[model samples]
Target chain A: MNTESYLDSIRRGLRGAMESDERVYLIGEDLLDPYGGAFKVSKGLSTEFPKRVLTTPISESAITGLATGMAIRGLRPVVEIMFGDFLTLCTDQLVNSATKFPLMYRDKVRVPLVLRTPMGGGRGYGPTHSQSIEKMFLGVPGLTVVSPSLAHDPGTLLKRTILESERPVLWVEYKSLYPKQLLNGGDELRIWQVEGEDGYPLAVVENFSGSDPDVVVIAYGGASVPLFESMRRLIPEEIRVRGLLPSRLDTRTKTPWWFSEITGREPIIVAEHGTRGFTWGSEIAAELNLTFFGRLVAPVRRLADADNVVPAGRGLEREVLLNEEQLIKAIVESIT
Target chain B: MILIRYVEQSLLRLYAQGLMGGTVHTCIGQEGCAVGVVSAIDRQRDMLFSNHRGHGHYLAYCGDIHGLIAEIMGLPIGVCGGMGGSQHIQRENFYTNGIQGAGVPIAVGMGLAERFKGTGAVSLAFLGDGTFGEGAVYEAMNLAALWSAPTLFVVEHNGYAQSTPSSLQHAGDLSRRAEPFGIPVTRTEGADVIAVFEVANRLLGQIRAGKGPRLLFLDTHRFAPHSKGDDFRDREELERINRECDPIQRLAAQIGADTYEQVRKAAEIEVDIVLQELGVQ
Candidate 1:
C-alpha cells in the first residue's frame, strides 16, 4: 500500500541526490524557498539545502552555459529550464558547449549536466508553455533524453540520471502526470539494468484476461494514460490485450526486445505524447517492423497529437491531443 | 604583446597562404587588453572564458603556441584533439567559445562554484564590444552582482562588432549599463599594456575579496577586419588609429630599442620552432 505522487517522488529524488553528494546542486529561476519551482517539484528542497539551491535570472542560455561550466569544473549542476519551449533559448549552449566538451576533450573532462523541464499538454497552458518537443533533440549525440511514465516512479529515474549519468541528460517531466500517484508503487521502481528481466528499462504491466492477446499496445509518458484506460474498456471478453511502457526515449543505452516477446497475429499499436510524424512512437514502430517482419499481423499503427499548435480551450485541446476514445478506436481497428 | 603579435602575424601569413581552415578573428591592435588582463591574474587558479578573437587571450594565459597553431591547422595533436578550430580551444583552466555572450553566464556559474567550494578563485569572461549588445551579458552581470559571485567581465572595446560600429550596435555608455546592477565598472583606454594590467589587477583583487562582479571596458581598435573577408573599415582612419595606439610599438618604446628587437626576435624564433614542430609549411 506504499504510494507516492509523481511530483513528490521527484522532490524526494532531488533531495536524496543533493543530500548524498556534496558536488551535486540545483540551479534555476525561482527555485528558492517559498517558491520551490514552477511545478513545485523542488518544494522544500531550498530550505533543506540552502546553499545548494541557486535561484537564477530569466536567462535559459546562460543557465545552460553556467551548468556546463560548473560540470566541467567538477560540479554536478542540475539546471531547470522552467518550460520546455524555452529549451530553444538554450540550444546553443546545450548543443555546442555542453554536449561537446566531454567528447571534444577526449574524456579528459566530463560534463555531468542534467537539464530538467516540464513538457506535454493537457493543462491548457497554450502554445508557448505546453509542448513535447523532445523529438527535436533526438538527433543530438552525447545527450540523453529520458521521460518518466506512470508505470515507473519519477524519483528513481531522476536519481539515476543525476548520480549515474556521465554525460548530459535532458529529463523531461509531463505536467499532467504530476498529481497522479503510482498505481502499484513499491520497490518495483528500483534502478534495473537495460537488459534486465524485461529486456528494457520500461516498467510494463501485462493485463491480459485470456490466453492469447489480440493486440499489443506500446506507449510512453503522459500518452500512456489514455492507452491504459482505453485498453480496459475496449478489450472485448473474447479478445485479450498487452501493454508496454518505455521510460527512456533516447535508446542510446539499449534497444527494447519487446518484439521478440510478443508474436503471431497480434497487431501492434504505438502511442506517443508529441506530434504524429517522425516521433518516438514512429521510431518504436519502425524497429518493431524491422525485427518482426515475418510475423503474421496487421501494420503497426501509431496514435499521437495532431500536427498543429495545442489550442487553449478544453474542447479544442481534446480534439488535438490523444484521448481514450482515440486509443480505443486505434486498438479496436488494429485487430480488425 | 610580442607573443600575441607574432602568433597573430604568423597565423595571418598562414591564413593568407590557405594553410588554415575556417575564419580567424585576429586581435592585431588589441593585444594589450589580452596580455594585460591575463598577466594580472593567477593563471593557475583563475579560470578564463574567451570569445572568437581569443588567440591573444589563449597565448597570454596558457602560452601554448604549438598547441594553438596545431589546432588552427586542424592537426591531430591540437588542444581539443583538432575538433575545435581557432575559435574554440580549451586547456588547463582556459576555455574559449565562438558564440557571442554565451560564456558570460557560464563564467558567472563558475564564479558561484568557486565561492561555494571556497576555492578563493575567480572566473573571468573575455568578450568584445560586439557582445555588449547581447541580453545575456546584462543577465550574467545582474546574477553575478546579486549573488556576489567572484567574476570579472572584460569587454575589449575595439570599436566594431564585425563591420558595424559600436554606435550602431550599442546605446549609451557600456560601463553605465553595469553600474545600475551594483557591479563596479572600470573604463581604461587600451594600447597601453601596463595601464590595462594595473586596472585589471585591482579589479581582480577586489573580485577575489568577494566584492561581487566587476566589468572592465578596455578601449582599443582593431587593425584587421572582424573576420576573414570582411573589409569595411575606413583605410585612412584605420592607419591613423594604428599609428597612435599600436600596443606593441607603445610597449617597445617604453622598454628601449635593444630590448624590443630582442623580444621580437625571440617571439619570431619561438613561433618558427612551434610551426616547424607541427610540420606546418
Candidate 2:
C-alpha cells in the first residue's frame, strides 16, 4: 500500500490552494529556492508561484503585521514562522492587531490570514527550539488554532484553512511528525474521520470492531502517534480504547460531535504533547467534566508531558515527554 | 485646519465635562501634518494608518465631523459604531490604533498589497518621535526598502513620547534615523501647512510612481497635554509654541484677518451643528 508522509501532504495542500486562488500568497523567511523553508514544508512552492511566494527578512513581528494588512486589504496571506517558538515575537500583531481588527472595525473587515509554524520536540532540539507552546494561544478571542495529526491528512486541513477560514488561524505543525506516514486503518484498527461544523475534521481510531470502548482518549497533533500505539497495545489486554484526534485545537465553545457519541459512563483521557496545567488538556478535561457531570464513571484524566523544559539529551527527553507507556498507564488507571 | 481645530477644541470641552469616556489625545498643534499629508493622498484608493493622536488625521482625511463626534461619544451612529471610541477608528481607507509602533508594518503590507493588485495606491503611516524606540518600525522600514513597497513613513516629531522628552529617549537626529535603511528622508517644519503639503505631495508622487518607500519627517508640537493633562514640559516653552508654532495662527496671518475670521466662523458653526446633532454639550 502506498503512503504519504505528513510533510509531503502539507506541501501538496499549500500547492493546491495557491493553484486555485490567485489571492493566496506565502510570506516567510528562508522560503525561496533550495531552502524551501526551514522544515521544507514550503518546498518548491516558491518556484511554482514566484511572485506570490515572498521571501522576507528575519522580522516576525513586521511580517505578521504585514500579513494582517494584506488580509485586511482583501488578500489571503499565509505566513510561515520558521519555528513555533518565534511566535512570541509576533504576539503583539496576532493578539492586539490581527485578532482585534474584525471586531474593532465593527465587522466591516475580515483578516483572513493563516500563520503556519512547526512545534514540538523529539530530535533533541532543546528548550528554545523545541517547545509545544500552542497552549499560550488557547483563549485568544478571534484566532483559530488547528493542529493536524498523522491520523488526518495534514494537507487537506491546511488547504481548507487557507481557502475557507475567514478568521485568522494559527496552524501548528508538529516537527516530529514530519517524517511519519499518514495513518490508514489495517485489519486490527479502524480509522475514520468525522467533520466538524466549522469544517475541521476529527479522526477516530479504534482497535476493536464491535466491542464498546472502555475509555475514549481525546488528543490532537503529535499526541495521536502514541495514542494509536497505546490503543493497539491495549487490545491484547482486552481493554478496548478509542482515540479521537481533531484538527482544530481551540474548542472553547464548540464541542466535537464524537464527544456526545461516546457513553458518559466510559472514562475519557485528554492527552497533549505540551506540559500539564493550564493547557489544551485542561480545557478539554474541564469541558468534558462539566458536560458529563455526575454521569462519568471517574474524573476526566489528563495525560501530558512533564511541566519542565524539554531536555536536549535523547534519554532525558524521552523521560520528560509523553510516550505510549504514559498514555497506556493513564488509560488503564482511568478505567480501573 | 480650521475644521480640525474646532473639532479638537469641542472634544476637549466634552472630555472636561465628563461626557467622553476613556482618554483623548488631540492634535491641537499638529494639524498642519494631518491636513497637509491627507490632502495629498487619494483617499478612495490609498490607505492611511494613524496613531493614538489621530483626531486631526481622521478629520482631515474624510472630514466626517459628525461620525468622529459620535464615535467619541460612544454612540451607535459613530463611524465604527462607537466600538472604536477615540483611539480606534476605521472608515473606508483610513484606520487608527492606540498602539505606538504597531501600525508601521501593517501600512507597509497594505502598500505591498496595492502594488501586487496594481491599484496605483500608496500607503501612509504616522509615527511619533517616541515610536523610534519600537523595534518593529525598523523592521518595517527594512522590509519596505528591501521589497520596494510603495509605503510612506510619516514621522510627526512632536518631541515627546507621552511624558518623556525625545532628547532623553533618543540619540542622534530623528531625521537621519531612516538613513541606514536607504529610504530617502525629507524634513519640514509642520507649522506651515502649505509647505507640508508641497513636501508630502512630492514624496507621495514618488511613492505612487513606484519609487519604493519614502520618509517625511514633520517637526511639529502638541499644545494640548498628551491624553488629557499629562504634560510635563516647561510652561514657558509651551506658551512660546502656542504663540509662534500654531499652524492656524500662521495661516491666518497669511490669509488676511477677514478671510481667516470667515473660515474660522464657518468651521465653528459646522462644529456646533455636529455637536448639537450628537446631543453633546
Candidate 3:
C-alpha cells in the first residue's frame, strides 16, 4: 500500500461525503475544467457534481465573506485557498467575521465552514508557496485545524471532519501527499482506522505500530513522512518509540490523552512545515506542558521552517532544515 | 414623532448638568430629517444605519430612549449592551458602528445579504453632509448601484459639519455627486417635516420595489451646537428658526395645542417620566 499518497483515498472520502449529505459542496478558484486546480485532486469533481461545484474569481476576501454569509444561511462550503500564503488576505472574513460569529451570536448560529489548503516545503515552491501557515490560526478559539499527511488519511479525515464539529475546520493537506500509492491490492480503497469510544475502529487514525518506548514523536502533514522515514533509519534497539499525526487540532484526539496516560506526562515533539512564529507549535507545547529544550536532546523541541524566509535553493534550504539525523540527535540527547 | 425631539432636548439637558458621561452629537435640529425618512419606511421590512448625529435616527426608528440615555450615561443597558457609548447606540433592529465610514460598508454588506435572502428589505444609511466626502460612502454608492442594492443614502444637509459649513468643506453638489453613479437624487425641505416625509416615502418605495438606489439631501437647519458642549447660539434670526424648525411645535399645531405652552408642558411630563425610568432625578 502506498499509504503516502492521497488521490484514491480522497476520491473515496468525497464519495462518502456526497452520499451522506446533499449540502456539502466545494467552491474555489481554478477548480473548473482546463485547470482542475493547482493540484489535480479536484479535476473530476466538477464532472460528477457539476451544478454543485463552483469555480470563482480570484477574490479570496470576498469569496470567504460570501461563504461566511452562505454558511450562516445554512450552506456547508469548503473553500480551497490556491496557496497557504493567501490566507492572510482574507483576515476580515476569517479572523473577525467567521471566528467571532458563533461567539458573538452566543452559539445561536454555527458556521459549518471548512478552509482546505495545501502546505508543503520539499517542492522548493518559493517564499509565496511553501509555508505551513495553518499553525498561525491555533490561537483562534473557534476554529479547528486538521493536518493529514497521507492521501487516504486525507479523505477519511475530511469525511470525519465534515461529519463532526459545530465550528469551522481548517484542513491543511500537503501537496506531496497527492497521487500517493494505491492501497487494498491496488483496486479497492481503504481508510486507516482508529478505535472509537464504542471499541469499534473509527476513521480518525488509520494505523499504529510502535514498541513500548519512553518518548514519542508527534508530527503532521508532509513532514510526517520524513519523520517516519527517519524512524526507520534510526532503529535503536529497546529504546521504544511511537509516532503521531495529529488528526484534529481543535479537538483533543487519542494522541494527547493516550500519550499522557502512557507516560504519565506530556511526551510531544510537534514538528510543522513553516516558520515557528504565528504558528501552533507553542500552543501544542503549552497544552501538553512540554519544556522546549532545543539543544537537540534536553526537553521537547520543535522542527519548523526557519524564521527568515530564504530562497528555495537547495544549499540555503538544507542549512536551515531538519531531517532524520537531526531527529535522531535530538532523541538520543533527550534519552541520555 | 413629537417625543423624538423631546428625547434629544432631554439628553442635552443631562449632558449640560453633568448628569451624563461621554459626549452626544445632538440631532436637535435634524430630527425632522430622520422623522421624514423613517416615517415612510416600513419598520419590519426596512433597516436604517445612523451617523454620529444619530439620536434623531434612533428615536425615529423606535430606538428605546432609556437605552439611548443608558448609552450616554455609560450604563450597561445602553443600546450596544453598553459596549458602545453614546455614538455607538444599537437597538434590536437598528444598530450603530465605529468611526465615520465603517457603518457604510456594514450597511452595504447588509444590503447584499438582504439581496440574496430575497427579503425586499431596503437598507438606508444616514450620513451628514460632511460624510459626503468619505471614500467609503463613495465605495458604498458604487457597490450599491452596481449590485442594484436596495439602499437609500440620506444626506442630512444641516449646512455645517461641526463648525465648518458645507459651502467650504464639501466640493460640488450632493445630488450631482450621486448622479455619476446613476443614482436618482432628490432634495427635500428638512424644516417642513411633511415635505421630508413625502420625499422619504417615495424614495423608500422605489428601494423596496427594487428600483435601484436613491440619494436624498434633506436641507435643514442646525439649531444646537454640533456636540453637547459646543457653542452654537445663532444671533441672526435664531429665535425665528428655533420657533419655526421645532418638529413638535409644527405637529402640535395640527393637533390643536391652543398654545406652545400646553404642548411643551405635555412633552416635558413625558420627558420627566422617561428620565425617571433612566435612573435620572
Candidate 4:
C-alpha cells in the first residue's frame, strides 16, 4: 500500500466527507477547475465533484462569510485561505462573526465551517506571507484550532473536524508538510468508528482535549512537531510534558480546566508560533483568571514569536521565534 | 392617530421617564416606513431584524408592549433576560440590536438559515439610511442576492442621521444602490403607513415564494429629535407636518369613526392592563 502524503491524506479526508454526507463541499479561492488549489490538496476534486468544489472570490471576508452562511445553511463548507496571514484582512468575519456566530445565534446555528490555510515562512515571501497566526485566535470563545504533526493523519484530522457539529474549526495544515510522509511510517489510519462506510466520520474528529496525569502542552499547526520533539527530548529526564495539539486557539474547550489542575491559578505557560501580543497563552491565562483568578498559583507566561513581523532569512526568522530550547525554558520558567 | 406616530409616542414616553434605559433611538416622526412595510408581513412566518430604533418594527409584529416596556427599563421581565436591554431584544417575530449595522450580516445569516431549512420565512432587516453606508450592510446585500436568501432590506429614511440629514450623508438614491447587486428595489412614502405596509407585504410574499431579496426605501420625517435626550426640536413646519400626517388618525379616519373607537378602546385597555401588571410586578 502507498504511504500517505499530507496532500493525499487531506484528499482522502475530503473524499470521505463527500461520501459520508452531501452537505460537504470545497469552497475557496482557486479551489476549482484546472486550478485545484494553491497547495493542490483539493487536486482532482474539481473534476470528480464539480458541484462539490466551488471557486470563490479573492475576498477572504466573503470566503469566510460564505462559509459561515453555508455552514449554518446545513452545508459543510471547507474554505481555503491561501495563507494564514490573510486572516487579518477579515478578522471580524473570523473573530466576531464565525467565532461567535454559533453563540449569538444561541447555538441554534451549528457552524460546521472549516478554514484550511497554509502556515510558515520559508520562501522569502516577506512580511505579508511569512506569518503563523494560529495563536492570535486561540482565545476566541467558540472556535477550534487543529494543527496535527506529520505523525498525525491529515485525512483523519480533516474528517474529524468536518464531522463535528458544535462549532466552526480553523484547520491550519503546514505548507511544507503538504508533501510529508504519514504518521509512524504507515498508510492512512483506517477508522471503523464511523457507522457507515458511505458516511463521513462525526465531523472529522475534532480532537483537542485530553485527560492524563502529566504536563499539558498546547501547540498548533507546524508547531506541534517542535512541541512533540521538545517533549521527547525533555522526557525520560526533566519535563514530563504531554503535548495537547488543540485544533484552534479557542476558549470553549475543557482543556483549560486541565491546565488549571497543574498551575492552580498560578501563572500557566502558553506557547505559540505567531505574534506574541494576541497570543493564545494569554487567553488561557485570562480564562484561568476569569474562572478562578484570586487562587492561582502563579502568573501566566507565554512563549511566542516575539511580537515582530516574521523576517525573510532563516537565521533571522529562527532567531526571533521561540524554538524547542526557548519553549522548554519558557515552560520550566513559568511554574518553577 | 398615525400608526408610526403612535408607536413613536409610546417609545418616547418610556424613554422620557427613564423607564427604558440603554440607548433609545425612536423613529417618532418616521414611523410610516416601518408600519408600511411591516404591516404587510405575516407575523407567524416572516422574521424581522431591526436597528436600535426598532420599536416600530416590533410593535407592527404585535409584540408585547409591556415586555418591551419592562425590557427598555432594563428589567429581567424584559425579553432577553435583561441582558440585551433596549438595543438587543429578540421577540417572537422580530429581533433588534443596539450595535448599529451588526444586525445586517446577522440578518443575512438568519435569512440563509431560514431559506436552507425551507422554513418559508422571509427575513426583514430594518436599517437606518445611515447604516446603508456601512460595509457590513452592503456585504449582506451582496450575499443575500448572491445566494438569493429570502431577505428584505428596509431602510427607514427618516431625514436625519443623528444631526446630519440624509441629503448630506447619502450621495445617491438608496433604492438605486441595490440595482448594481442585481437586487430589485422599490421606494414608498414613509409617512403613509398603509403604503409602506402594502409594498412591504408584496415584496415579503415574493421573497417567501423565492422571487426576491429586494430592498425597499421609505422616506419620511422625524417629528422628535433623534432621542428624548436630544435638546433639538423640529421647527414649526416640521411639527405641523407630523401632526397632519399622524398615521393612527389617518387609518382611523379611513376605517370609519365606529371602527376607530373600537380599536382605540381595545388598545387603551390593553395598555392599561399592561401598566397594571407592570405595577404589580
Candidate 5:
C-alpha cells in the first residue's frame, strides 16, 4: 500500500479546501502549473484549479497586504511565502494591518488569511533559508501560529486553518518534515489524536502496553521525527517514554491538556527545532515551572538547536540542529 | 464642501477648547479633493480606503457628523465605537487607517475581490504626496496593473507631510510616478470641486469598465496645520494658498452671494446642532 508523505497530505488538503469552497484562493510566488512551487508542496495544484491558484510577483509585503484585503472583503486567501525567512518582509502587514483590522475597526471586519511557508534547518540551505522563526510571531495577539509534524496530518490542519479560522494564521511548515511519512499507530507504539480548544489537533504517542511513562517529552513540527525515533529506540532499553506532539504551538499561557496526564515527578523535556533563547520551549518551560511548582522531581529541561546560526555544511548544520541521538541522550539522562 | 468645512472648523474650535483629545488631521483647505472624488464613486458598491488625514473623506463618504464627533470624542456611539479615534473610521464600504501607503495594496486586493466576484465595483484608495516614500505603494501599483485589478489610486498632494515639504520628500514630478507601472495618470487642481469630480468620475468609470487601474493626482493644499499647530511654512505662503486654493471660497464664487450665504449658514447650523447634541460644545 502506498503511504502518503507529509507534502502530499498538505497538497491534498489545499486541493480539497479549494475544491470545496469557491471563495478559497491559493496565492503565492511560482505557484503556477509545471513549476508547482519552490518546495513542490503546491505541485499540480495550479493545473487542477487554474483560475483559483494564482502566481504573484516577488513582493512579500504587497502579497500579504493583498491577501489581508481579500480576507477583509469576504474571500479566503492562502498566501505561500516561498520560504519562512521571507516572512520578515510580511511583518508589517501581519502585525500592524491584519491583526489590527478586527479590533481597530471594532469587530466590524474579519481578516481570515492563512500564510503558509516552509521553515527548519536540516538541509544545509545556509542560515537565511533554514531558520525556524515562528517564535517571532508567538506573542502577536490576533495571529495564530501552527506548525504540523509527521506525527499528525499537516494537510488536515492546513485545511482547518483555511476553512475555519476567522483570524489570520501563520502556518509554519518544516522543510525536513515534508518528505517524511505520516505516523500510523502500531503494536510497539500507539498514536492517538487530541483536539485543542481552538480545534487544532495534538498527536500523542506511547508504547502499546499502556504502562505509565517514566518521562514525557513535549515537542512539535520538525522536532517530532527525532522524538519518535528516540522513543522507539528507548523501548528496548526498558525506558518508558510518552511523547506529546502538538501541531498548534501558540497555546498562550495555558498548559497542554495532557499536562495533567504526566506525573509531576517525572522529568518533562520541551524540544523544538528553533534555536535556544526566548523560544517556544522556553515559554512551555516557564508555564510548566509555574503550574507544577514544588511537585516535580526535576526542573523542566528544554532541548533545541544551539544559539549559533545554521551553517551550510551538512556536518556543521547537524551539530547545531537537534537529532535523535541528542534526544535519546537527554531522555536517558532525565530518567536516570 | 461647505459641510466638510464647517465640520472641520468646529472640530478645530473644540480641539482648541481642550474638549477633544488626540491629534485631528483636518482637510480644511483640501476639502475639494475629498468632496469631489468621494461624490463620484458608487457609495453602496465601491470600496474606499483613506489615510491619516481622512476626516474630510469620512465625512464626505458617510456625512455622519455626529458619529465622527462621537468617535473623535471617544464615545461608544461612534462609528468605530471610539476605538479608531480620528485616524481610523469604518462605515460600510468606507475604511480609513493611520498608516501611509499601506492601504494601496489592501485596496488592490479589494478591487481584485470585487472583480473576481463579478461585482463590477472599483476600489479607491487615497494617499498624500509624502506617502510616495513608502515602497509598499509602488508594490501595490505594480500588482494592480499587472493583474488588471479594478482600482483607482487618488493622490491628495497637500504640499506638506506633517511639516516636511514635498520638495524635500520627493525628488521628481509626483504626477508621473505611476507612468512606469503603465497606469494611466491624470492631474487636476484640487480647489476646483467640479474639475476634481469630473476627472475622478472619468477615471473611476474606466476602472469599473475593466480598464485596470488609474491614478488621479490632485494638486491640493491644506489650510490647517498637519495635525494641530505643526505648520512651519512661511506666513505669506500660507495666506496665498488660503486665498487661491480654498474649495469653499471657490464654490461660493461659482454660486451667487445670496445662495452661498444660505448654503454656508445651513452647513454651519447643521454642524452646530450635531455638536450641541453631542454635548461637546
Candidate 6:
C-alpha cells in the first residue's frame, strides 16, 4: 500500500521537480535546510539541494517579483508564501508583473513560477496567518490557481505544475489536509478531469457510487475535507448525493464539458474555505448557473466561513470556519 | 539619447494634439542614466528592469524606436503588440514595470538564477529616488547581499519621487540606507552620460566578477513634469537643474557641438521616417 502525508507529498513533488530539472529551484522565507520552511514542507530539501533551496528575507513582494525575473531568465522557480494572508503583499507583483508580462508581451516569454501557499483557517494562527483568500485571485488572467484536498494527490499535482505548466501557477495548500491521507479506494464513479494549459489534469471528483444522485455537492481545498466526512455520516445507501471536487479555479476550459453529463434538476451546493461574500463559490455558481440555469432545482446554495476575520481562540476559530454541521445544513437546505 | 528625446517630444506633441490615447510619462533629461547604465552593462548575458519613465531605457537597450513609437501610438506593430504602451515595454532581456520598486526584488531573482546556473551574468534594476521609500528594495538588498547574488541596484536619483522632493521624502541620504545591509554603495553626481557610464561600467565589472550586490545612485534630473498634465514643480529650480545638468547638453560639451547637432539631426530624420510609415505627422 503506497501511502503518504499531504505535507510529505508536497515536499516530494518539490524534490522531484528539482531532481529532474537543474533549472527548477525553491525560494522563500526560512526554506533552507536547518529551518526547512515555516511549515516544515522543505524539511530535508535544503540538505540535498543546498544551492537550489534558498531562504529569502521577509519580502513577499520580492519573492513573487524575483521569481518572475528568474522565470523570464529561463529558470523554473517556485516561491512559497510563508502564510496565505501575506499574499496581499505579493499581489502587486503577482497581478501586475507575473500575470501581465506574458500576454502583454504577446507570449515572447513565460513566467513558470509556482507560488505555493498554505491557506484556510483551522489552527489558531489568527487573522494574519490563517486565511482562505484564494478568491482574491479569481478571474486573474494569465495565472492558474489550484488547490488539493483528500481527493487528489498533492505531490502528483505539484510535479505536473512545475514540469508541465506554461503560465504562472498559484498552488494553494490547506493547513488541515497536510497530515491526512488522500481519498482513494471507493466504489467506482465518474471522474471529471479538466486538462490545464499543459494537459495536466485539473480533477473534479464526481463520486456518486452508482445510484441516481439527488444533489451534487461541489467543494474544494479545506472545505472538501469536511463535506466528505458529513456525506459519509448522513447516508450509506445508493446515490442520495454526489460529491464534485474541483482542484483548479481560473479561466476554466473543460469543466463545462462534464456539466452536460450531470443531467438532473438536482440542486448544486458550492462549498469553500473563503468567507461567504465574493468567493470562489460565487464564480463556480455563476458558471454552473450559466450552463444549468433551467435545470437547477434551487438557487445554488454556498457553504463557507462567516464574513469576519479568523479569530485566534480555538472556540472562536471553530465558529468562523466551515464545519460538517454547516455542510449538512447547506446540502439539506438545497435538496429540500 | 537623441532618439529617445525626439520620440518622447513627439509623444508629448501627440498627447497635446489629442492624437494619443493615454497620458504619458517621459524621461527627457534623465536619458544619461538609461543610456549610460544600459550601454555599460551586458545586454547579451545580463538583464535590465525599469520603472514608469522607461522610454529612454527601452531605446538604450533594444534601440527599437519604430516599435516604441508604434506602441505609444497604439498601433498593431508596437513592441508589445500595442498592449504595453510606454510604461510596460518588454524585449529580449529587457523589461519595464510601472510600479515603483517592484522590479528590485524581481531583479534579485534573476541575480539568484544567474548564481545558481553559474552563468556569471549580472541583473541590473533601474529605480528612481522615490523607490527609496519602498521597503521591498531594502529586502531585496538584504537577500542579494546575504546570498551574495550578482545584482546591481541603479538609483536614478532625479531628486524627486513624482512631485515630492528627496528631502521631504526622507531624512538622510540614499547610499547610507544600504550600508546597514552590508551592500556596497556608489553615488555619482550629475546626468552626464560619460560620467554615469564610467561609474556603471566599473560597478558592473565588479558584479560580474562575483562581488555580490552593488548599488549605484546616479544623481540625475527629470526635465519634464511627472506625467503628461501634472505641472506642479518649481519651474525656476527645474530650469536651473536643466541648464546646469542636462545630459544631452553635457554630452555635447564633451563631444563637439557640430557632432552633437549631427547626431540629433540623424535621430530627427529617423523619427520622421517612422512617423511617415505609421501615417502620423
Top candidate on lDDT is 2
Write candidate 1's Cα lDDT for B76-163 as tens digits. 8887878889888888888887778888988888878888888989999988888988877877887788889899989898888888
TM-score of each: 0.94, 0.98, 0.71, 0.79, 0.97, 0.95
**Which window of 10 residues has the lowest lDDT sum in candidate 4 chain B?**
B1-10
lDDT of 1: 0.82
The sequence of per-residue lDDT tens digits that candidate 2 reaches over residues A1-336 is 438899999999999999999999999999998889998988899888999999999999999999999999989999999989899999999998998888788546889999999999898988888889999998999999999898898898899889987879999999989998888774477889987677888888888879788899889998988888888888899899888888888875656555755677788888999889899888878778777778988888888999899999999999988999999898888877
* lDDT values, one for every candidate: 0.82, 0.90, 0.66, 0.67, 0.89, 0.82
The C-alpha RMSD in Å for every predicted model, in order, reads: 2.7, 1.2, 6.3, 6.1, 1.6, 2.3
Best candidate (score: TM-score): 2
Candidate 2 collision pairs: none
Distance from true position, residue A154, model 6, in Å? 1.5
TM-scores of the candidates, chain A only? 0.92, 0.96, 0.82, 0.73, 0.96, 0.92
Per-candidate count of clashing residue pairs (backbone under 3 Å): 0, 0, 7, 43, 0, 2
Off by over 4 Å in 1: A185-200, A209-212, A235-238, A253-265, A293-296
RMSD of 4: 6.1
DockQ of candidate 6 is 0.71
lDDT of 5 by residue, A192-217 (tens): 78876667777888853646788889
Q: Write the per-residue lDDT of candidate 4 for residues B101-185, one digit (tens) a residue.
A: 6566666666766666678887788888778776767766777788787988888777677877778888877768888989988
Q: What is the interface RMSD of each candidate, in Å?
A: 1.8, 1.1, 5.1, 3.8, 1.1, 1.5
**lDDT of residue A141 for candidate 6:** 85
Among incorrect, acceptable, medium and high, the docking class of model 6 is medium
Candidate DockQ values, in order, are: 0.57, 0.78, 0.16, 0.17, 0.73, 0.71
Q: How does model 5 do on interface RMSD, in angstroms? A: 1.1
* Residue-wise C-alpha lDDT for candidate 2, range B1-281, written one tens digit per residue: 99998899899899989998998899999999999999999878999999999999999999999999889989998999999999999988999988889999999999999899999999999999999999999999999999999999999999998888899999898899898999999999999999999999999999988889999999999999888775778999999999999999999999999999999999999999988888874
DockQ of 3: 0.16
Query: Which is the better candidate, 3 or 4, if ranked by lDDT?
Result: 4
Task: Give the per-residue lDDT digits (tens) of candidate 6, residues A1-336.
Answer: 346778988888998989998888898999887889989999999899987887877888877888988888789989999998899999989998888888887446888889999998888999888989998998788888988777777787898789877678999999888888666645343444565444434455544555667777878788877877777756753336677666676646634444554554788888888789988788778878887768777888888899999999999999999998888777776666
lDDT computed for candidate 2? 0.90
